[model samples]
Target: MIKTLMGSIREYKRDSFLSPFFVMLEVVMEVLIPLLMAKIIDEGVVKQNMNYIMRMGVILIVLTLCALAFGIISSRFSASASAGFAKNIRKDMFSNIQKFSFSNIDKFSAASLVTRVSTDVVNVQIAYESIIRVAIRCPLLLIFSLVMAMSVNFQLSLIFMAAIPILGIGLFLIISRSQPIFQRVYKVYDRLNNVVRENIRGIRVVKSFVRSEEENRKFQEVSQEIYNDYTKAEKIMAINGPLMQFTVYTCTLLISWFSANLIVSNVMTTGELTSMITYLMQILTSLMILAQIFTMLTIAQASGDRIVEVLGEKSNLNSGTLSIETVPDGSIEFENVSFSYQEDSDKLSLRNINLMIHNGETIGIIGGTGSSKSTLVQLIPRLYDVTSGVLRVGGIDVREYDLSLLRNNVAMVLQKNELFSGTIKENLRWGDENASDSELERVCKLAQAHDFISALPDGYETVIEQGGSNVSGGQKQRLCIARALLKKPKILILDDSTSAVDTKTDAMLRQAFKEEIPDTTKLIIAQRISSVQDADRIIVLDAGGINSFGTHEELLGKSQIYREIVQSQTKGAKVDETE
Candidate 1:
């Protein structure tokens, strides 16, 4: 909680300064108004002096108005400050997430990330705003009221001081007990959120498979666990209020009883006794406020720990310092490369792989489902560091080059093409920010997306839904292709991206590839034989190693796995006839 509070303070430097200044003025109002009340009670009302009452009342009204004005203004400052703090933290988290490798994202589920950004940030925001309410004003009132009470009557001041420590100790013990409970509560909260998010994303699949009851039962179990944990924490903290009230009432009764004796003995006046009682109320009020803030910290601390877990993870891949000016050419090589997700695991994803890709060549890669084809290409950008050997790009070790520069030189359209919610032109411009309509069309033509774009009512201005759910799979693939083409990269990789499109459209897209981006080196990972039939070279992967690497004609002449895949995917006629 302290860490989270400090983060907010650092985030909103301007608002932090302004908020405290206004809050100090507000505290001045709290203290001054109480003193005026005492003045009005004792001097004015006791003497029956109209002028004294009127003057003190007017001053009290002014202080009350100022306090109200300052308090409202300070609260606004807290709202603005807390909002900015959460926003900045969210933005940094987003940027950091973007920098994370696919491996990193896989470690923390999408649902968990959403929870941290949304719910966890909310915790910090509320904690920060509460600082102005309880953190600032409560302590100010506690200490100042003690001073006033002490100055009025030192003997009674001991009672107020004694009450404070009792309240603090009570808070300390409650938080200590509740902290562990809060941690478990937050864990349950994350699990509960995960159930909801998964249910939403997989609703279509769930309905299609008719597993609605099973999913609901799973959700109910998690929800019940969350509720139980929450109730436990709530129950632990709930005792704080009643215990505090009990202490306050008992202490007040004792103070009043003892003070009456002092007043009767002529040691204190009626006005003094009245003011002491009000001060006693203020003390209890501060203690209640303290308890609330203490409880908030316990919960926020749990949330902050969760947030820090994500922010502290070091990226597996580091972006290098290589610039565009330093790019040698479109050439790549892997030497004796071996990789495994676990360091201690003996099994490797890609083993002893030696390969060289030259400029302006279409290299087709094929593999069984777990053949490491995607993982092979993923290494070129150093998404995951090789356990044993080197992967080089543009004649430089990929690790030696800045990640941004290496990525900039390579354009990849994944098997799953995800589009942001934005205009068609905006989506295309992700590859090259300065790309013009003519440039967009040229790439779109190559990707076979030009016709679709032209047919849309808004043309380039047409808005796409999240994940391009509004568009057909093939259309989304083509748009992804166009985006990749817009970069005119040193190396272009399409990882079975055209699988969604029909053979005819695939053929047309291949033809467009020949006209535009003819100089760019291309690596096509395809399932269908026709897609790779015209390639300069085709590589087959099996059991984490290269099974065969040769021209399509050479592969047909020799490789059995390649032949079987082609046979299963195609029937009759010459195997390469479709291409």
Candidate 2:
């Protein structure tokens, strides 16, 4: 764990010893001020020397002001350094997440990543601030003050020096025991955050089914676990506060008692005894700050290790060497393709699959669930790598081309259409940043969306609530289609895209698709057979393997799986060979 933390701290070379050095300057001022205070009290005040008192008094005041100014400056510098530090860490974490293979993502939940990036980053930030603030100051002042106190009178300082090391051992024990507890608290914190996020996102369902109490109970279980861990850690940490106070007060009593005897015996002047007593108090208080610093350092390190885990992940799909001076329309071919999410992966999603698609052709992929239909289409954009295959886009091996270039030519309307919180026009612009109003209207018309959009009070300017929640399912689908159309991609993929539309609207969409989409290669993944009946070719998948490939007419006459599906879904009316 300590190595993991040290590795993360080493990530930002700028944060290397420099940040700590700036912070140590603060410790210098903290120690200097207290010593000046002792001088003012003993040398200036006790001897009844007004001039000596004023001279030291002014010097102490200036140092106090300088310390205050330094504290503020150091605080600002620390905040700036930490802010950039956390930002760079999160940036790397996001980039790493994007690199992780789909299989890797399945091992962790979205809620877990959310907690790691947010709450965990905060813990690191707190640790960074502690380094600049209490952590450095306390330890430095304590060490320096201990030296000064011991120098003042060996016997009196002995009382404190003796107790402090014992206290130091006790502080170390508290930190070590509590470190594991803090990690557990963060784990439970992730679980609790997961429940809260799920509940809030699914609140409509809970309210609709009147299951609020059930949800509350579920939330309570996770929340209670988090509270228990936090309470245990806090309880353990709370011990240090009183233990420090007890040690300091005891040291003070011993010093005061010895000081009185020294002065009465003429072994020490009144001013000298007073100065020694003051230094003893300063030394003990500084050690207390050191105690808190030690405790927080342990926890911050745990948090930093998590941040490092995210930064270190590498994506499986590399942006290859292919550059597209010009895309060769939308031709695609797959040869001897076999793929699985794991090694020695015998559960092939596509086995010995050979297929070719030309520019301006319409292809439909039909498969039952678990047949890897989506996974097959996903490969075109390099979302996942095939375990065994050579995939070529535009007559070039996909791995030979830059990943971004391949994706730019392909537009995939995902099963789940996502829209950010923005105006309708703003969302549409994602496809074509420079698209004019006419270009926007052109895509909307092709998507069968113009009529409804015109009906809205603000038309294309209408503000959409987050995730397009304010829009109906069909409207959101049409808007997503419009957004895709605006890209003017060389290839378009519709992955079960029209599930929510009425049959009439679906036909209109297909008609508009045929008329307006300029002979680009189109891949349609559909549960509805009628949607793809007129396709130039249809591939039927069963049990993660391609069972047959032919025109709709050929499939209807030949494949049994295709026949069974046509029989079941076509309602006994003679299944149309060509719609």
Candidate 3:
């Protein structure tokens, strides 16, 4: 995990190194101050020499300023380094997520990934900043203060030995008890984020169903769990403050009592006693800082683990050694292909699927809810590699082609059309970034979207709200279809994309396909028989396997399932006409 996280510190290595170097200098300046004061008290003040006192005081001022300067430089460097490191980490994690296949994405929830990249990264950044500066200064200050105290008066310094062990043991117990609670709290955070995301995205449904009170109750339950765990962890960690104070006071009292007796016996000078007291404060302050650092590190450890998990994930779908670039044609062949979302699972979502599709052929697929219609088409672009057997595109194994090259040649407009917040022109440009205005208009015409788009006041330049909420469902689907048509792909798969459009509009879109792009292989998945009855052929799937495959009329005569679907739809159409 450490190695994986450190890789993100690429360009910040210099700042990371300089922060600690300046921190070391600051500690040295601080450690020398007490010694200078001791000199002024003993050699200058005691001798009644104004000149010597003034000289030593001036040196003290310079040392004080130097320490302040070092502190400021270290802080600036640490801040820059930590912020840059965090930016790189977020960028790396997002980039890695883009490479993940459908199967890889199934391993983590969208909310969990959001938490890991945002909250978890922030925690790691804070810890990193502390590690570079405070972590370095505290240990150096402690060791230097200890040495100076013993040099001033060896016997008196032994008091710290007992205090140090007591503080160490207390801190150990607090950290050990609190760490597990922190780990659990972060997991609950993922759930909390998930709840909020689901609630917001489905706010319309929630309001329609009058489930606002139910959602609020669920949110309160998760929030209370977080509060309870945090309260428990803080209760354990609260022991740290009182324990540190007790140790500091006890050691101060013991040192003061011993110093007075030694002063009376002339075993220690007044200057040395004064310096020893200063060193005592320095030593105790360092211990307090160290305790805070340990607490922060404990929390950050969990966050670091979560971040490493994202960075370390390797996408299972990788292009083979073959550099096959351009697809020869729209032809696709699936030979005894089988797939399961889980690699090791016995259950299969698609089983022994064998089919052949010639270039420019129009195919229709119909099935029950879980028959894997989308799954089958997803394999053509290598969205998820087949669990067994060979799947070929353009007469070549898909894995053998460059992933970008293969996906660019196959366009898929999913059931749920997504439109980002942008001008309509900008959103459509996603299909072809450099597409001209004329090109955009042509594809929209073919998708039956140009008429509505031109009717709008702003036409292509109209701004689409997030998720295209401002547009009707049919409009969104038409815009998505137009966008996919701009790809000019060799094969186009529409996974129930036309379900929102009326029957006449759907028929017009199919007509445009036949006239405008004759050589593109088209696969349409729809529930309505009217959508696929004119296709060159249709597939009926059942229980993860092919139930029947043939032209529309052939299936109506020979397949019971096809006849039932057609008769039911025919009756519904007649009823609509009668009404």
In model 1, the Cα lDDT at residue 235 comes to: 91
Q: Tell me the tens digit of each residue's lDDT in model 3 across 1-579.
A: 888999999999999999999999999999999999989988998888899999999999999999999999999999999999999999999999999988788888999999999999999999999999999999899999999998888888899867888899999999999999999999999999999999999999999999999999999999999999999998898888899998889989999999999999999878888899999999999999899899999899989998998898989999778867589999999999998888644889889999999999999999778889988888899989999989998999998998999998999999989999999999999999999999999999999899999999999999999999989999999999889889999999999999999999999999989988889999999999989988899999888889899999899888888888899989999999999
Q: What TM-score, computed on C-alpha atoms, does each candidate reach?
A: 0.93, 0.90, 0.98
User: How does each model score on lDDT?
Assistant: 0.84, 0.79, 0.93
TM-score of 1: 0.93
Pairs that collide, model 3 = none
TM-score of 3: 0.98
User: What ordering of candidates by lDDT runs from best to worst?
Assistant: 3, 1, 2
- Per TM-score, the best of the predicted structures is 3
* Candidate 2 lDDT, 1-579, residue by residue in tens: 445444444445454445456556655665566666666667767767788888887887877777777667767666766766677667767877977866667666788788888878887877777775566666776677667766667777778768977897888889888999887777777788888888888788989999999999988998888788878888898899899888877877877788888878987666556566666666777777677766677777767666676666567778776455656779989998887766456666667778999887889899899888888888888777778889888898887777767778889898888888988999999998899999999999988888999999999999999878999988998899899888888889998888888878888888888787747889989998988887889999887778889999899888998988887887644445443
C-alpha lDDT (0 to 100) for residue 436 of candidate 1: 83
Please say which candidate is ahead in lDDT: 2 or 3. Answer: 3
Q: Clashes in model 2: which pairs?
A: 99-315, 322-400, 322-401, 322-402
TM-score for predicted model 2 compared with the true structure: 0.90
